[model samples]
Target: MTTRWALLSVWDKTGLVEFARGLVELGWKLLSTGGTARVLEEAGLPVTHVQEVTGFPEILDGRVKTLHPRIHAGILARRTPEHLKQLEELGIGTIDLVAVNLYPFRETVARPGVTTEEAIDTIDIGGPAMVRAAAKNHEYVTVIVNPSRYSQVLAQLRERGEVDLFTRRMLAAEAFAHTAAYDAAIALYWQREIYGREHLPSFFFLVGEKIQDLRYGENPHQRAAFYRLPGMGSGTLAGSLKLQGKELSYNNLMDLDAAWNLVREFHDPAVAIIKHTNPCGVALGETPAIAYCKALQADPVSAFGGIVGCNRPVDKEMAQEMVKIFLEAVIAPFFTPEALEVLKAKPQVRLVAAGEGQGEGLSWQVRPVSGGFLVQEPDVYDFAEQELKVVTQRKPTEEELKDLLFAWKVVKHVKSNAIVVAKDGVTLGVGAGQMNRVGAARIALEQAKEKARGAILASDAFFPFADTVEEAAKAGITAIIQPGGSIRDEESIACANKYGLAMVFTGVRHFRH
Candidate 1:
């Protein structure tokens, strides 16, 4: 009877000895290359080196180790009569199982002072080739790229003498996914090096590792999971440490990300209170405690059961104020010891810490549609004062400009059609995701009520008509700021002038969906 064969060549040598021993116990022959062969031999297991099988010594400082036809033909051969006759003629044994994990090219490049040569040296060429070959011939072979599957594969092999077709298909899918991600990392490095920073690649290769399987998606009945790109730095929720509280649900993470991104926009101490992935209130203050208070006071009714994010560390004062309401979570750079103790008072509230490291340079945002997907760079533009074009006859006062800039930042975070009313760097009311601009304006002004008299309005997009301006003027809006690009810009400007309201055209629209 012909002996079954398994080949192993891995950069990560996790569970290699025990897994090989299991295969040996099942009356299988083990063939390994380089360090894997040495480790198996050291573990007192009989191992055949690949050079012995291929009759070729490793050359070119180990770069030309496993690219020989002997290695690939063994993994790729179909178990047909003609193929078996040829394999017997050449004395080549069919490799029934292949366990391989590629080199750490992604990690090597992510290092702080890594050179281009070092990164190129770490890219594993032969490993991916073997994996793809085995995966393509999965009907007759089994492939293992992840170490976590070793025990399961070993159990199935021991029970049935061969891997089942269902498991082999699943393993093939995983192997393909692994190779795709590896290629994407390599492509990203070369593209960034060749194209430089300013240009975006026309083709996008996106791959992510599953970080979590959530309880549900947006709702309890829907299934959901979360995946994070490798080396997505500490600034994002993937790297955030959950210091305390219950497991984060899908909605909690979404709202946390929204609040965290909004708070990071301000240089000073800032607070962003969010609900359902929209900023209900946002404010900047001298301290986090003051910021939280003002943000919550913006719309106390909407602040209930919301997520809070701070640009600065959360102190005892901020924690005390936060626990007073039923908040879902709080995220910040850090939290004081006293603040942590106070926050623990509410066992259900999630506390997360965003560490110092942030993702490098420009990043892409992806969304799934019905047929395919959409990918674009994140909207990180920060418009300066010089970029503003005052369309109204009356230019905004310096104090009003300060407040308008503050409201502009807050309005960008709100869903469109969005309108934000603010005064003194504190958001009074935010109307988000409305059907019409007039409806958004009415909601914001109505929420602000008496406070809207002195506050300035910030619209997310150009006003298509003068109806929104007329409504804002009736609510005592003193000034207006919007991306004034509509064809009817003159109509809105004329209305603003008629109402004696100072309006500034940013010439940049922020239409968040």
Candidate 2:
């Protein structure tokens, strides 16, 4: 009678035959149940069936195969005298190693239209029982669940004739984690499927795969890495393809995210130039080349060494204009051969080819804090012209209304206390991350100076007082758009009338922090 016996029962048979053959070659007997035994026997490997050991045939549509006392008693038995005597008296063998994997419950329920019966049938009852039995008695019994760990397990068995204590403990921990994640997925799906709960649950289960290790974090001295959700959509930066230049750093990814998100807000040809996670210049045009040039002209100095995001492909003309100014990176859907030829001259610059922008999908925005993280839904609100309330007596003309909408789109992407002054579909000045709304208005007006005369201004939030409107009047701003939710909304509206400014209240605020 062989003292070292291995039990193999699995739903996923990725590398079962080779693993069984290796154990047999190492002089260890194999014990398996239904599907796994069929696979091993077909491969001409000798395997003892669970029915032969337990004297009970599998019943109930093969659900009662491995849940018998003979199987679990062998795995859970200790090496003590009393345990050994009980197993010996019952004619049960000691199962040293157990290899099992659960059914694909997550994949089954994740399909488009999975029904209750199909999902319920896919859940395994005996697999988790066997895995937990082996994991709990890890001091005496070794466990194997993941196929990736097969080669290492066989190497240890061949080298030492048995798994070492350290390997057994490590595998035990991994087995517990594997079962935990599987159960979490089941709980989440059932809660959504049965109770129709969309809010956050009392408990959260997060699983992530490491994308890459960056050079550093926000600073050079700090270490950082990037992780992606298991099934995230392709619209995100993690799914983007890096076609050229070096690996992205932490700061580069942040700036690229800002630029890419801002550029996607436009339907027409548009370009967004971002620096330090703020839009320095943004514009729209009939062609991508013209858009890039106009965006650069908006704030040429700030555009230097910034990231550029284009909604359309980059052609030779656009590439020509891009090379004249030093930029940190460029991202677009595609690039012509001629454009690539000219752009490749600057090897240090990063070039990314992302696919077309997709509409907003169900996703969560996560931010880490000291202890844990904060999760919220993404901001995908659209400000339509019909939703605007003309608060001032002097309504905006058609042209002013067009520029106001453009400025509104751009200002939403900027940081909190943000302001943007625009005319003719191009930004004249942008003030971002100010302490007060009036301070932001002053900085934007100072930059727009002469350009402020006919430009329309857009603010992310309402003006607490009438001071912002008063300053805009002094700066020659002709029109203004804001959310207008303050207690003194009448005061701001009265000041717009005083300046003869065309003011509209969106009744919605976009505060990005």
Candidate 3:
């Protein structure tokens, strides 16, 4: 009998028949259950029905298919003397390779109005057991979980007609990750279904499959990889289908995400120019043409090499104007024929279209630490006018209030302890990623240059000290909008009064940290 017993089961039946044929050619008996067996039998491949070996039919609507001892013993049995003797005595065949992938619970649950019964039906109990069995027996059995690993496994099998210890170890690691991510999706959905929310995992872990290895990380020396949860929504990458350009770097993804978010905030024809993950300029106009011009005029120097996003389609005139300046990325819902042609001429421009993206509304964000990831809800909300309190005696002018609201929206997405100064639908200046609020205020004032005078200021958080207010006063800032939560709110209010700056407390705070 062949020692290589290949157990195959998969929801995504990509390359399964071919892989099974290859295994059979190499003298490995294909052992499978359910749809896997049917697929192979239909394809006329030699497959041993798992029930013939286990002596039991699938029960509980296929939930108890591969959870038997006959299957696991073959996978989990040690290669040591006593284990080998016991396996031989029990007629337990040594299962060598397991090709398994779980059901698509994420998709089932994500569907509109999907009942809990339907979602539960899609969760496979047997799949996780098989995967974990193979992973636990990495010392003796080879496991293949992701189809992405098919080529490498095929290469190893073709080159030597067998999987090596090193390859088996890596495959086992991937198998665990596959099942973990599968379980996580189920856990999140289950909690959301029953408890109305998925609480933080006490001992949380996620296994993201590598989508693409980027050219470099934040810098050229460091390496980076784009990872994705199998069934979860793909972020900017899913929506952004790159037309033509060099591959995106780590920093490029950052800037593009920021650009996409800010531009999406407005429904009107709008343009948002982002540099280093912060909006340098944003404007809403009658058309994409007008929006681009207004955004460009906001701060032309800073807009250089920035990522530009628009809510409306890009037209030929807008594209022609765009060619006049250098940019890293241009993203829009659509682009007119002439506009695409114009941008096509500029091959270096990374153009992306969002019209064919995954869904109507999607929110996903990822953060990386030295060792792992930190993923959570995106900072998304609307600030109602009723939430505002007039901290200063004087009420803001209608125009000033509109500009204040604009500046306030821009300030939230900026880095922590950040401050933004804007007026009349234009960004006067932005100070982001600063340690202290006062320092950020000072930087914005300096960057604004002559434009600082009379521009409204918006802070992501309340001013801890009165110095920032004092600085804005010296810069001739006319109005301020911020969330008032500082312990020294009275002192800050006094300083705003002293400087004659029309300040308001927008009870809703937006800290990007």
- 152-191, model 3: which lDDT tens digit per residue? 8777888988789998989888888778888887876765
Best by TM-score: 1
Instruction: Say which prediction, candidate 2 or candidate 3, comes out ahead on TM-score.
Output: 3
Clash count for candidate 1 is 0
If candidate 1 were superposed on the true structure by all CA atoms, what would the RMSD be? Answer: 2.6
What TM-score, computed on C-alpha atoms, does each candidate reach? Answer: 0.91, 0.86, 0.88
Predicted candidate 1 versus true structure: per-residue lDDT over 1-513, tens digit per residue: 778999999999999899999999999999889999999999999999899988999888889788988889999999999998888899888999999999999999988889999999999989999999999999999999999999999998878878999999999999999999999999998988898755578777877898889999999999999878888867878778889999899999999999998998889999999999999889999999999999999988889999999989999999999989998899998899999999889989999998766644337777899998887778888877999999999999998999999999989999999999999999988899999999999999999999999789999999999999999999999999999989999999999999999999988889999
**Residue pairs of candidate 2 with colliding backbone atoms:** none
Ranked candidates, highest TM-score first: 1, 3, 2
Q: Pick the candidate with the highest lDDT.
A: 1
Instruction: Indicate the residue-level lDDT of 350 in model 2.
Output: 92
Measured with C-alpha atoms, the lDDT of residue 322 in candidate 1 is 93
Task: Give the poorly placed runs of model 1, Cα more than 4 Å off.
Answer: 21-28, 41-46, 79-82, 112-116, 157-162, 197-202, 360-362, 498-500
Clash pairs, model 3 backbone? none
Clash pairs for candidate 1: none
